[model samples]
Target chain A: MIEALQFEFMRNAVFAGLLASILCGIIGSFVVVNRLIFLAGGIAHAAYGGIGIAFFFGIPYIYGTIGVSLAAAFIMTAVTIKAKNRQDTFIGVLWAVGMAMGVILIDLTPGYHVDLMSYLFGSILAVPSADIRWMAGLGAVTLVLTILFYRDILAISYDAEFARLRGVPVNLLYFIYIALVAVSIVFIIRVVGLILVIALMTIPPYIAEKYVRSLMMMMVLSVLLSVVFNMTGLWVSYHMDLTSGATIIMVAATGFFISLGVDQVISFSRKRKTQRSSRKMLKTKKDAL
Target chain B: MTQVSPVIQVQDVSFSYNREPTLTNLTFEVPEREFLAIIGPNGGGKSTLIKLILGLLEPNHGRILVKGRSPRKMSKIFGYVPQDVNVNIQFPIAVMDVILMGRLRHRGHFGINKQDRQRVMELMTMTGIPGLENRKIRDLSAGQRERVFIARALAADPDILILDEPTASVDTAGKTELYALLKDLNETKTIIVVSHDLMIVSSYVKSVACVNQGIHYHPKNEITETMLQMGYHCPVELIAHGQPHRILKTHGDF
Candidate 1:
């Protein structure tokens, strides 16, 4: 693993992974807390349309993906916000259509034979320095926005109508948040592929949430956990010549299941402790009587 | 019954969903320091009334005046609690964080200062959850969580407190304690609660408005069984008293 750092691509991959961890920590917390996993998963898949548009138009994949992702994000936002009970179908449709569009657009792109799997199943080992810069810039914006609107975002996430009643711009903040989620998917797609982005975004936060009492702490823990996963995954994948994205996601999934088992063990002990305390209280009461 | 300074005035307001009428030509006034209970059956527009007052939904016609200003304009001064908190049950938010949200209105930024923390603690004490500030909201019982939400609403220190089905998740004893808390709170601020627990609510609220597409406003807290039946536009079969036992005799038609 240390020897691999001599390669420029490996160094770039490391930077990309670190940035991805921070982005996932902040935005993924909101996504998980707001129960937007399905919507976010939809956005991750639907970002394929942006890739298609970029390739077909002979533009940079980042710009095309951002454009299409934002459009899909806003459309999904409008649908979910307005169509109270029927948003699932809309998201499903968009998710499928986006993937299909990307496939067809790539098919028609005239000169794209190799390296396609990189986008679908990530090529973290081949991350370019330019993409790393892009990730850093987007990560900074997400951090600043989250810090500035921390209170309003927390209010909106906890209870949107109550936030609206308290004069928080719920809808506007929601749109901006969704937009950021869409844009951030571009960087995540670079690190983990669209197929595995949701796992990386959700797993760390899920584990962090179980241990933390506050969203801020949850975010901090998610970033730390994600970094550990990414580092471990990168090291193992490098040693074994495995797919970096898949390796990372496997590490996170393992962490998730382990956390579940830990929770069960902890809860069992807590139950026993409570029972013992209750018995002690009863005995003391009897002696006093 | 005691007509005094009005804090919220709904004048000839009407609202519709998909061109279907929800509230029609509703006119009412919530006086300062009054506890108003909005009771009606399902699909009777109780939630919609609260929405209109909160400026979430604008009326198709007429207007809502909150403290002589439009509801939207004075939204900062209105504290609202919905039927449910509408958050994921496992959301990682501490009780202090939940209540601290009440102090975020019209604030420039997000840091919780000493005074904000003090205010949150004060509210927790006022609502009877003083020691649970550090507990995760999801870990709390239904009754304690309700108190946290109510304390959150009070944390804003708004002039009006509005709650929709605040006792739905709470038990009977919890419901009574909640009403008593609201009754205590009513001495300083106006409160509008949309509730289906009419019997207990009528005992605490100073005025009752039975909304069913339109509204039947009662001025006194003493809402008789017959008046409630008329307001429901049907027979009041289920009587929610000490225990929710049906006072109606068995039907002979069966």
Candidate 2:
């Protein structure tokens, strides 16, 4: 298993996986807490339009995806802010429109028969050194920004109105958050397809939330969990010739259930211990009387 | 009282939602360091008026000024505690972490500094929730959640504090504690509250603003039948006092 790391493709894959894990861990916490998973999904699928645009215009996929995803994210954020009461309906419309545009554009590309399945699912083993470099840069930027605005993000995520009243630039912080999600999604699409990216972005953070005491701690744990699932999924895919992205998502789902089971067990034992101690105290008081 | 510029000023302000008038040609001023309670019936534009002053909503007509500046310009000078801080309490966040958010504006986009941490500690101390910094927000009771938001708001050390129905969901003990905290805060900072509990507010606040489509200011005194009739759109009679004071009335135009 250790010798498998020697291949250049394998090395690139591991690097990309680690970088992607870090990005997902940091941004995914916000996504889960803010209930922006659906919005993130909209942004991810909307990014396919960028792929189509990139293929059509002969631009780099990363730049095109970033540009298009940012635009979509801005629109989504603006709509949600302006009409918060109607967010679900508006986000749903954007998601459909974005997916439809991507499909239509991809169909229009002349004489190009690209393997859409690879892009739709993902081929982590096929990640090149260039992709790994891009992932690393995105991961670094996300980590730095998250650390810098940790307090503001925490306040905004929990109670935006209160945060705003405290002289925090709530609107500006919200935009920055959306932009970070866009960046994360652009890179994440390469590891998991647009359809499954939200799960990858959400599951680890959700699991980490149970054990971690702080947002920062949750981010660290989520990254570790994401890496574990990614590496395991990659290994399984290599051995069984399975799809990489789907396998990773399956592994993550398993981890989520296992974490839930563990939490229940811990809570049950704690309850029993407290009950026993309370009963003992009651018996001691009775004897004293 | 030491005289200072009015902490909040609303002049000729009018607001409409979806073309339906909520507030019309309203004018009011909250003096610095004064505890003012706003009372009105539901859908009477009370919350709308507060939101306009807070810059959460743009008024359809006229202007709202805070600390001698428009609401947009005075965004940094005021702190607000909303009616319910439990709107998303189930969200995975800690109480201390939530309080630290109040210093975000002062610390900028980067994380909190040592001063920021100290400020959060101070707020927790002031709010009497010092040891609850590590507790998850969802695990707290409603009253505890309210204190966390109060700490968060106070973290900025603003000259004015505005709260919307702070006592609505709290118990009697929580309400009393909240009023006492506001009373102490009023010694040096302006405190404005929006509530429907006229009796409790009358006993605690320095002055009261009875608002429906408009507003009528009253100095500290027992709320009168006429005031309740106008503010609540119903005939109100004060019943009993000392131990238990209640308002007796039936729906008139609510």
* Interface RMSD of the candidates, in order: 1.5, 2.1
The TM-score measured for candidate 1 stands at 0.91
Chain B structural similarity as TM-score, candidate 2: 0.86
Here the TM-score of candidate 1's chain B is 0.85
Q: Which tens-of-lDDT digit does each residue in B149-242 have in candidate 2?
A: 8887788777788888777667877778778888888888888888777555547778777777777776553454566667655212243664
RMSD of each: 4.2, 3.6
The digit string of per-residue lDDT tens for model 1 on B1-254 reads 44598888999999998878999999988888988878777887889989999888999999999889999888878778877764567888899988888888536544568899988888888777889989988889877888888898888888889998888788877778778888887888898988766555546777777788888787765444544565554223346554432222233522
Error of 1 at B25 (Å): 2.1
Best by lDDT: 1
User: Could you give candidate 2's per-residue lDDT for residues A1-289 as a string of tens digits?
Assistant: 4688889888877787888899899899889888899899889888887888887777877887899899999998998988888887887887778778777777887878557887788778788788888788878878887877777777777777766666667899889889989988888888877777888999999999877778788899999999999999888887898898999999999999999899999999999999999999999999999
Model 1 agreement with the true structure over A1-289: per-residue lDDT tens digits: 7888898999998999999999999999989999899999888888898788888888988888888888888999999988868888989999999989988998898977436678877888878898898889989999998888888898899888777777788999999999989988888988889889999999999899989988889999999999999999999899898999999999999999999999999999999999999999999999999
lDDT of 2: 0.80
* Worst 10 contiguous positions by lDDT, candidate 1 chain A: A111-120
